[model samples]
Target: MGIGDVSKRVLLGRKLRSSQLGETLLPKRIALPVFASDALSSVAYAPDEIFIMLAVAGASAYAWSWKIGLLVALVMLTVVASYRQTVHAYPSGGGDYEVATVNLGRNAGITVGSALLVDYVLTVAVSISSASQYAAGAIPALVGHEATAAVVAVALLAAVNLRGVRESGTFFAVPTYLFMLAILGMCGYGVMRLLAGDLPEAESADLVIEPAAGWEGPLGQVALFFLLARAFSSGCAALTGVEAISNGVPAFRKPKSTNAATTLLLLGLIAISMMMSVIVLAKQMSIRYVDPHELDRLRTAGGDALPEGYEQHPVISQIAAGVFDHFPPGFYFVVTVTGVILVLAANTAFNGFPVLGSILAQDGLAPRSLGSRGDRLAYSNGIVFLAVLSMLLIWIFDAETTKLIQLYIVGVFVSFNLSQLGMIRHWTRHLRTERDPAARRKMVRSRAINTFGLTLTAVVLAVVLLTKFIAGAWITIIAMLVFFLVMRAIGKHYEEVELELAADEQDKVMPTRVHAIVLTSKLHKPTLRALAFAKATRPNVLEAVYVDIDSRATNQMLREWDERRLDVPLKVLHSPYREVVRPIVDYALEIRRANPRGVVAVFIPEYVVGRWWEQLLHNQTALRLKGRLLFAPGVMVTSVPYQLESSQAARDRRRRDDHRVKAGDLRRGRVVRDDDQNQVGR
Candidate 1:
């Protein structure tokens, strides 16, 4: 293997056959982490957001943290149930975009698609940024360079996912499960300690919180309502990845919808449980957290400020520290696993965004390149695209989770509202045609569920807009609008191209005359081959066209043409500006202008090289000439490739590669038995 191939194999592992796609499908246990990691990992930071927002009003408002969690959990449950209907109704993995397009109109679908696209990008950015924050907390050396750490984390995740879905999932499964175990086990043991009246207070319990200036004397009902609304909206970050399962139904094993739904239920239950437990424990232990910049608000019991650079640990970190203080290993275990899982949470977007991009490409709404899978049978282009976008966001926001969080749940809620509305329409339309009484009843129940989901999500959407619009949420909105316009423009462009290319009687008509011109620089093997091929066509007009870039070579070529007694005529196009492509292009156009009714076929002699540097060394002039000639009317550009020795080596290498066994060969029914193999060997 070449160095490049070996490096690729090392980075992405072995390529899987298309038949191995079934092996990539996940059972519920694996799918839970694969699709639900984002939602599950939010338990690490979602409560932090809630506490931070409430901290603005001092510890007095902290009493409402669990209430906000309940509300957010309620919305999550509604979304999960609504999407269960979606999975069963459209198990082809179209998810929200498909539901909106089919039941609502194309514009609605595009809006949902754009929202989901932006949401996926933010998922990676937010999750990785949060992970970096946790890493910095655990390792103080990484404190100031969070953005750089997050960028590196994103690169690592993208590389793992490029290997294929199942491999990536397997790689991440252990950490995700460990995070669940650590957090839940901590919560369970903390509760037991509390019941025994031996629960320890959080490290920050002695620090008194001072409410922000405007919130110090909160007395009006309007003020309290707005404060709670803001806290609730921030808490809803937990719901960011709930819809990933809907978009990834096809990646599940047989009975895909059922498995996806079960995974979705598990995600909601675990995320809700963890979030509530952390909030309650923080309150029970008097954990104090505020915006990182507002550390002045925290005071010692003596009414003195804490020392400079007093970094407040995250809510979960503090809770873990307090709950496992006696068992130092448990605290380290929870902290380590939480940070790892938060980073891997971005894996959900890596898997989801690519599949959605592929579907969009298939629908002509995205770049066609996204539809092509890489050697590992994964959407490698989409994976790289997501990584680049996430890196840009992390750089722009400096990988600060609080800043990135403002741009968070807005896109998700936009998709949620639209998708729930779409699901309602989907069930309504189906109810009209579904004849069985039981199925009708089921459709009615599902429609009702979607309706409730829509209502709840619409309210949350309003709150997200109202609370977060100025806090960077408008960036998410603008991104969605840009994506929607770009997709619409792409669809329109494809439609115009298809219409223009439709076949008709004119397509079948032969040209009045065939005029062939072989583009050549010298009378060497490549040029001679081009001339011979052009003559084989037996055109009414055949000539060799050369631009006089160098007088010495031109003179030598003319002398060889005459001395060799070549049957084809040789024409020299002079260039005063010392340009190659324009002279030859002008000559081709001049010929077409003279014989407007005839076709001008320009055959350019080109060298095919296996090495990358060889490609750069040759074919500069020929490539430019062909590109210019193709746009001219009544002109056809053709390349007669002359393969170099390197090309033969490349061909042999490919032959050897084609014979190697891949992951899904047996499932594809292409496996050979031992008897046939032995006969061939003999």
Candidate 2:
């Protein structure tokens, strides 16, 4: 009906009724990629990190790669199992924050919330960064501009996520699955080659790696253990998105927890297998991977640097290149799918952030706006917020996965450890109240699972802290602290406001007297009408108050009032400050303090016009005066609308179009229809 509506439909497509949300409920087939992409996608960069840590002390430390990967996998499996319990026990979608807060106290919950929030933002940043790298690999022209490409990828991700979750998920599902297939397919072929003793080394295998400043020549146990710990910490990146399924349980259909748990288990198995296999293949193939910028440090046996601009491909890139050494198309396919999967990985955060935001809003920790569902049954505000925050981070970090990944898993593990501890406490408390033997037995078993998860994750959290605190873990710690404080402040403010504005016995008490004031700028029809309306209320005292900034105008008004002999007295207050609202508010407050039990009713005449710009020209002062007066104790500010000639047209248009489009609708064009997802919002 309007240009505003027209633009929205163009960007976000047609508007659907709020009742059709169920139509967006994900089936298992689509749901897997929607939520699992983050953890699954981490394999692309996680292995590279592990190799980097190992190569720090030279390649001799490389033997620890598989051991660290196995340890990380074991921890991941524990985390997944624990979260399966989390989803089942708490499926309202608050995830770790809700569980920790409910069981471990508000402090723990806030910690988890901050961690989760930070993690979600990084999920977008890291995923988009990885996608950019993959994009560069696929297209040589994008080489030096990978950071720019990464940022563009993030921008594209933000746009798609703005549409809504189910829609975005469906769109991302294909690439995520393709990535899984590619990696799994690569690993399977590498296994066959290994069996046949014919696998080729990576193209860059001949390039030597010079260790960082500290490790010149190290067979020392201390250096080896340190390298192993660092590698283990780096491999921990694989666990970054494991908690998403727990956070996103409600996104599933009926039996939400069961569906979510199954997804989690499948994610763990697939991720562990894919990751371990890739790491093994890379080592066996003698993939000469190093930090791209550090490639000049690498030298061949003859002591010559491998050549300038020697583009070292990523772990997957190396594997893909080696596996498809002769078959160029297979390498291209792997690169293409890897790029798609990395970009799509952000969808996991898109799904989780909105759901968590809705829960936070309900608990009065976030803005009430997040509590409302959009036409697509999604928490649209939350989704957009996540997108914008992630985009900002992506831009700031230049979408370099290596740089962005520094801020990655610390938050996720913070949530993981806290959530598990909370679940353990939850089981303990539940067991105390349980009378039924079978349910009690189940609780005991769950407690055991959670306890194991807590131990494992706590160790991982400690390892991450010890190994990475200086390597950007502190950034995440600071972020969690910031989020925790913010949530607490929001909660406090909401509580205070709720208490101050609360309707109760005290609020119902009537004032001893009512003193009504009519604001008059001139003796026009509108001012006269407001005067008459104020008098009809029959207050104990009634006065027409005018701010006398202009003496000539005030004199003319006084003379007219005197000649007319109006029923209510006219009081003109001189404002040397020439302030419109301040003088009126001070006058009202003086009357209130003099008679503390009396109520002040301030009535201002306001102009209502049809066109948008026309309305801005009139009644600005009256609106300001009314706004100021409302803050006074025992004061009621009312706007008496004087309809302009154009107002009728505006009203007719409003009558023809009635819809409440809150946030996130500015981009959508107006094409309203009954969409399935919108049904949930109804």
Candidate 3:
């Protein structure tokens, strides 16, 4: 139809009617990648974070890597189990926010909502930033421009997601599955090599790690405990995306809760296995990894620093290199899929955040626009909002995964702790009236699971605050506070507006009289049409009003009006300041003040043009006058459109679009061929 419409059609495909929303429901196969990619992709960076935190104490502390992995796995499993109960209980898809609100109080619900919103934004930032790091390492061209690459990646991801959840999920399902296969296949082969006693060491195995300042000697139990706690806190990033599935339960097809619960189980198990495998394999292969910024800590066995510009590979990459040493394709495939999957991991957030935003909007805690679906049946506003916020974070942090990682997980854990606590309360409250013995037993079991989850997550949240507050976690806390305050203010505003807009008996009363004024600048077709329309309304009083910015034209129009012997009277208001809009506005306000029980109707003629540039050529005064009159009490502004000849172009374009053939026209028997029409006529 138009350039913009064609471009949008190409980018987002054809728009679907509201009835097609059911067609967009994701099956379990597609839902896994859509909702679980974030949790699954964490294996790509969780192990690296674990090693980086442990590297501060040098490689000697690396022996605890597997222990931290196990601890994280335990927390992840507990969270997954807890959320299964959540999905079953709250299949309407409010997830943590709903649970907290219903069981706890409004404040607690808002806290969970604010926390989840912040976490979803951070999910996209961290996931895409990590992907950028992998890409930079694989392709040296992107080394210095990681932030730029990350921003572009985020933009493209948002575009794909704007097409709708089911479509985006189908698109991302391939890479997500490939990543799972690559990592699992690599782990399986690595385990086989280990069993055969032929597993080779990583490329960095020969390098020795030097402990940072104050950690050169053996540490006391207190120091060791603190070091382990920091490492564990960082490792717990694996649990970040577990709640997304709970938030996205409605996206799944038939038996939504069951499919979602199954997906969550698969996510937890696969993520745990991959993370544990990577950490164990790295340990077995003696992968000497450290913070990328602190590469100086790595030295050769002869006490010599590494060659200048030596780049340290991530833990998974090193393990892939060692495991696939004999097969170059295997290594490349693993690396390629790992990078791709990290980018697609942001898709999970893209889906979850919008749905959560919609829920918040429905609750009056977010802008109403967030609750509306775009033409493609997606929450386009929410998606764009998340993308912009994430790009800002990526730019601010320079797309450094390590730096961004510190601000990660804090919000998710905040939601996790509150959600689990709420779930416990949920089951407790239901058990009071759930007198069926079988259902009561089930409720008790779920409560116990939630209780355990709460204990573990509470401990993790405290440890995260304790270990990461100075390491940039404070930024996340401040962000959550800002979200909380903003949402509260929005809810309050909505409530006040609802009260103000409530209709009263006085609202039904009609105005005592109608005072009509047709705004005229010249005695031409548009002005004549406006005057005729105003007279047709049969108001109590009617006059043609003009703002005399140009006296000569005004006098000439007056002479023509008198020559034509027009029945309607013309009233001219002289403007010394050459202002056209203010005089009309003041006149209308004066009339409104004089007749408080009456309505003043101002009629203005506006030109309708087809070409975009023609719009700026006319209607300037009418636009300004209408804008001013809208705010005056009891004043009504009506636009009488005068379509120019060029306006036919827009009407013709719409007519052509209406006849365009769509995909299902043939099958639906809606297509008509000229030949068929002629035969029917005969």
Candidate 4:
């Protein structure tokens, strides 16, 4: 094969037949990491965000960290329970978009789709950006180049995901599991130490935090309420990926809905555990975390500023250090896995976005190209599109996790609130006709759960807008609106095109006559071949036409035509401006104008070359001529290819490549033995 093909094969492995799609279905073991990584990995930074928001009021506000964590966890649990009903109701993988569209209306569905699409892109950006920060801490060389490093990490993750869902999941499953183990193990050990009354304090435990300007004294109830609301809004980022499982139920194996529900439950419980543990441990260990940019707020006990260049570690990292103080290896393992899992967390978005994109495409709301699977049975276009948009975001935000975090969770919650509302409507609509009392009772229960979810999420969404709209969430809202408008325009265009392309009775009418013209520059083999092919069609009129840019060459060609004594007539059009394509185009258009009810067929000979550079050397005039003729009414343009000698090499290379044995070819009985080939030749 060619170099490009070989490289792709090496990168993505062998292509699989469409029938092998069932083989790619993931079991519960693999599906857990594939879809839950984003929610699980949020524990790494969710607590940090909680502390950053609380730090505005200084360390005194840190006492509320555990309370906010529980609040976020409670929202997550309700969301998970709500989506369990969603998967059972809509197992087709449309997730929120499908639910909203089918229950609410077209506009509602499009809103959910747009919201999810924006959120998925932000997921990749936020996850990879966070990972880059961790990498910068571990490797000092990456401190100033986190954006560049993040872009590269996004590209690598996209490449791995392009190799098909099952394969990418298998690759990422290990790190995701390791992260879970490391965090849980660390939390368990830290709690044990606390029970034994021997838990060491965090490295920054002694540092005193000074309240920001205007907060020098005790705060009123109003100020305290606002502060806690903002902190809770920020902490709610833990709920961002809870809906991914509903969006990806089709990727699961047998009993897809059940497996997906189980996975969602597992994700919610584990995420809540890890998140609550980190917060409680941070509080117990007196982890003095603050906004990385505002580290100056932290003061030494003697009322001295922290030394310049004193880096503040993340909440989890500080807790890991204090819990594993006696064993450096434990600290390193926890830190390493945390960083790796953050990067892999974007895989959840990579899987969800493309499937949702495909669904939109199938519904004519997105470009049709996004619906087609690549050679590896993955939605390659959607993956690449997500990667590019995320890289742009990373570059624009300079890969600062704190800055990007402000734009996070807005879209997901938009989808979450709409999805829960739609689910409530879904059960209500179905209960009207579901006759069986047992089934009715179950539907009523599901409706109640969804109703409760809707209430909680609706409140969260309002709080998010109130607290974060000025903090960067406005950008996400604007993005969702743009996506909605664009998809609506696409759907309208597809509908119009469908109507315009529908066949009618007039389409069956034949042309009155066929007027054929073979474009010729010289009396050579290619020109002669075109003329012969045109005559064989038995048109009502046939002739050879030439554009005479030079009189000397025109006369020489005329002399050759006369010498050959050809039967077909040759007509020459003189061009004073030395333009070749315009004259041919004008002549064809004139003919078309003269015969509105007839057809004008223009055959042009084009050279086919194998080498890429050879293409630039030929076919410039013919290409332009054909392009111009295509727009003329009642005119048909055809290219009669004359293959150059170099083209044989391309054909031979393709033949050889087609015969080569690929992985699984022998097992599938696609390989031809040497003896069998010899017998066929004999």
Candidate 5:
């Protein structure tokens, strides 16, 4: 093997064969973590968002946190229920995009795709940023460097996800369940303390949050309503991962749709319970919270700014600290797990985004690269793309969850509202054709569910837009528009290519004559080798061609051609503009125009090298020539590579990389990733 292959294997682990894909298919235990991590991780920071919004009006607004949580819960329940219908209706894993396209037309499908693309990007950004903040709070050395930490977290998450959805899901399920258990356990204990009339106070309970500029003091009823709306909109981050279940129904074992729907329902219930409990507990304990930048506004009981370097823990962290203060280790455990869950939450996006991208690619709405599966049956390119984009956002925003959260939930709510509206249309259209009485009743019932979901989510989207458009919602809107145009362009290009490649009698008919052109930079072994190969082909016409960008080089080559008396005829194309591709492309087109039935075979002599820099040194001209030639009609470009000696080292490196320890290496016996999987024996 080559050095490149060795490096990849050493860094990324073994390259699983196509037959070993079954080893990557995760069971329910692991799948839950992989798919549910994002929603479960929201408990780490969702409570903090609710409290921060409520803290704008001093302690009085804090009472409404629970109410907002319940509202979010209601919407989440409706959304989960609606998606259950979707999974059953479209078991193909196309999710909302498929639902909309099947019923609402191509435009709606494109809209859903755009919205989902934006939402997935935001999911990675928000989750990683939240995890970074949590880490900063837990580790003092991490302060002021959370942005860097967030990027690193994103890289790690991407690596895990590139291992494949089922495998990532299995690894994630533990953290998802652990996070759920930890928060629920803490909430239950806090309730017991409340009943005993000895519930402890939060660390921030003694601190006061001074509201930001316009959010202060007693306001009119309209203003109050607006404030509440803004708060509700922010709390909707909990719904970011809800659509994933619809996109991942096919990942489940037998009865994929049924299992996915059940998982979705469990996610909703768990999320609601966790979010509401955290909010209520924070309110009861007077947990003080503020936007990251406004941390300067919070003061202690003695009317002093809290210590300089003071790390403001999140509401859940504060609650955990207070609730488990007597057990120091337990407090740290809770905090650690919460942070871990946030990072893991991004796993949901990793699983969902690639699946969606693959479907889009299959339909020619996304780049073909998205449809390319890796050795482990994972959409690796998609994972890498998300990771890089998320890293940029984290770095730009300093990994401050408060700042990043502004850009969080808008796209999700947009998708939800559109998807629910589309689902209503889908059921209505189906009911027209599906005339069985029982089926009609079911469709009507499903439509009602979707209708309610649409109404609820539309209101949330409007609130989100009103509150966050200036803050960051425009970012989401712009991203959606960009994706919409890109996808449309891809679809158009694919259609154009399909039309261009359509076959007829002319396509099958052999060319009337073959015209050969050999690219000659200088008269050497490469040029001589090309001449011999062309002679072997015995084309009707053959000549050596060179772009004369410089007079001295052309004159020197012409004199050499005369002195050497080369077998092939030499022809130089004059170009005063010093262009590389355009002149050659035009010449090839002119040749095709002269004889429409002729095939112009352009042979490019290229050097094959092992090192990255060697590639830069060689094939600079041939690569560009080939790219331009492909766009010209009736032309075929072939690379005739003479492998350089450096390539041998690369080959050796590749062989070493593919060598791996087998399944039975351990004393405890073999540990197969997927139990039902079997090896592809040689």
Candidate 6:
């Protein structure tokens, strides 16, 4: 095999056949980490966002941390329940986009699709950027290189996912579960210490928070409400990945919808527990964390600003330090696992975005390329697209979580609100026809749940728009609108092409006569073979056509053809500017112009080179000629390949690859028998 093939196999493991797709189906254990990592990993930073927002008003606003956490958890649970209903109702894996399109009409579906697409991009950017920050906190070397670290992390995640869903999930499952255990263990230990009245204070417990250029006294009710709304919107970042499960129900194993719903419920319960527990612990331990760039807002207990070069850790890091103070290993374990999960959280987007992209492609709203399966049966194009766009965003924002977070949840909530509204309409239409008592009762329950979810998510959407638009949410809205318009244009293009290509009565009619033209440069084996193949077709008119770029070469070719007593007439088209492709294209069009009801067939000799660079030296004129003739009306262009000696190397490489071990081959009991070798030999 070639060096490139070996490198790819080493990176991605092995090629998986189409039949092995069933083996890639995820079970609950793996699927939980694969699809739920985003929502679960948010606990690492969701509490930090809450604390950072409230820190604007100093510790006085800290009292509302638990309140915001609880409210966010409520919204999360509502979303989970609503998506459970969605998965059960629509298990085709289209998720919210499908629901909206089928129930609310095309525009609503397009809106939801565009919103989710933008949110998926933001998910990767925000998750990897946050992970880089956590890495910087734990390792001093990564402080100023967060953007570089984030881009590298995104590339690695894309490679892992390119291997396929089940494989990548298995690789990430350990870190996700470890993160859950570490936080839950820390929270449990911290609570035990609190009960024993021996819990140590956080590192920043003594530091005082100063309001950011605001009043030092009590605020009016309107100001208080605005502050709460801002904090709540920031805390709702935890809900960013809740809808991924609905989009990925087809990835589950047996009982796809049921497994998906169960996974969603478990995700909600675990995420809510971890989020609220961390907030409670941070408050109890008096963990102090502000926006990293706004460190001037913090003062020492002596009421003076801290000295320069003093770094502030994340809320979880500080809480971990305090909770596991006596055990340094436990502290490092928590920190390490937190960083790993933050990176793995982007896997949720990797899984969902590709699936959604495939569905959009199938619906003609996206490029048809996104619908193709790779060697691993994954939507690799979509994965790579998301990775590149995410790296661009990370670089643009310099991997600052605070900067990217403002653009984080607005798209998600826009999708959330519209999805729930669509679900409400879906059930209402179903209730009009569904008659069984038990089924009707279940549908009614689901409708009521979605209705409630719509109300809650709508309020959150408004809050997010109001509080974050100026903070950068407008970028996300603009991105969504651009995606919507682009997809609409793509759909229109596909429709027009389909209608133009549709066969009718005129398509089946036979042409009046066939005129075959052989393109020749010299009387070599390739040219002779092309002439013989063209004559074999027995066309009404046959001729050897040459572009006379040089008069001496054209005269020599004419002398050889006349001396050989070739039966076919030889025609030379003169190009004053020495253009090869356009002259031949014009000649063929002139032939078709003479007989309007006839077709002209043009056959050109092409070299089949094994190596890429060799191809650059040959077939330059023939390639351009074929491209031009393809656009000519009533002309059929064909390439008669002349395989060079070097092509044997490519054939040998293909033979080797066919015998290589493939993914799931052993599990499927596929042994490479003698017949496989004989087939390659043949």
RMSD in Å for all candidates:
2.8, 5.0, 1.8, 2.0, 5.0, 2.7
lDDT of 1 by residue, 1-682 (tens): 6679889998998778888889888988889999889999889888988999999889888899989989999999999999988899899888999998988889998999999999999999999998888788778899899999999999999999999998998988888999999999999999999999999999999999998988888548998899999999999999989999999999999999899888888888898899999999999999989999899999999999999879888888888899988889998999889888889999999988999999999999999999999999999999999999999999999999888888998988988988988888878888889999999999999999999999999999999999999999999999999999999999999999999999999898888898899987888899999888888888889999888878998999899999999988999998878998888778888888998889989998999998888989999887777777778999988899999999899889877767766656666665665844531111
TM-score of each: 0.95, 0.90, 0.97, 0.97, 0.87, 0.95
Top candidate by lDDT = 4
Error of 6 at 280 (Å): 0.7
Assess the local accuracy of residue 88 in candidate 5 as a C-alpha lDDT between 0 and 100: 92
lDDT per residue (tens digit) for residues 1-682 in model 4: 7788889989988888999888889999999999999999999888988998898898999989999998998899999999999999999999999999998899999999999999999999999999998898888999899999999999999999999999999999999999999999999999999999999999999999988888778989999988999999999999888888998998999899999999999999999999999999999999887788888899999989988789888888899999999999999999999999999999999999999999999999999999999888889999999999999999999998888899999999989888988999898988999999999999999999999999999999999999999989999999999999999999999999999999999999999999999999888989999988998999999989988888899999999999999999998989999998888888887887888899999999989998888999999988888778878888899899999889998998888767766667666777656744531110
lDDT of each: 0.90, 0.83, 0.91, 0.92, 0.82, 0.91
Ten-residue segment with the worst summed lDDT in candidate 1?
A: 673-682
lDDT of 3 by residue, 243-306 (tens): 9998898889989999999999999989999999999999999998888888999999999999
True lDDT of residue 328, candidate 3:
92
Worst 10 residues of 5 by lDDT: 664-673
Ranking according to lDDT, highest score first: 4, 3, 6, 1, 2, 5
How well is each residue in 1-682 modelled by candidate 6, as lDDT tens digits? 7688889889877788899999999999999999999999999888888888888878888999999999999999999999999999999999999998998888888999999999999999999998898788778999899999999999999999999999999999999999999999999999999999999999999999888887467878888888889889999999989999999998999899999999999999999999999999999988888888889888999999898888898788898899988899999999889988989999999999999999999999999999898888889999999999999999999998888998888888888888899999888988999999999999999999999999999999999999999999999999999999999999999999999999999988999999999998888899889988998888899999988999999899989999999888999999999988888888899999999999999989999999988999999988888777878989998899999988988998888876767666556666444644622211
Which has the higher lDDT value, candidate number 5 or candidate number 6? 6
Kindly report which residue stretches of model 1 are placed more than 4 angstroms away from their true locations once superposed. 646-682
Question: Could you give candidate 5's per-residue lDDT for residues 1-682 as a string of tens digits?
Answer: 5567667665566677788666676555666677777887777777777777777777668878888888989988999989989999898889989987877788789989889878887888888887777677668899899888888888988887776776677677777788888989999999888889888998888887776778687877998897788888888888888888788776777677778878888888888888888888888888888876778879888878888788777787788888887898878778878878888888888888888999999999988899888866888888887788788878887777667777788777777877888888888888879979998998999999999999998988888999999987887888888999999999999999999989888668889999999888899888888788887888899999988999998999999999998878998998889986777788889899999989998888888898898888888878888888888889988777777788877777666543443554443343333455743222
Off by over 4 Å in 3: 660-664, 674-682
Return the top candidate by TM-score. 3
Better of 2 and 5 by TM-score: 2
Candidate ordering by TM-score (highest first)? 3, 4, 6, 1, 2, 5
Candidate 4 residues lying further than 4 Å off, grouped into runs, are 660-682
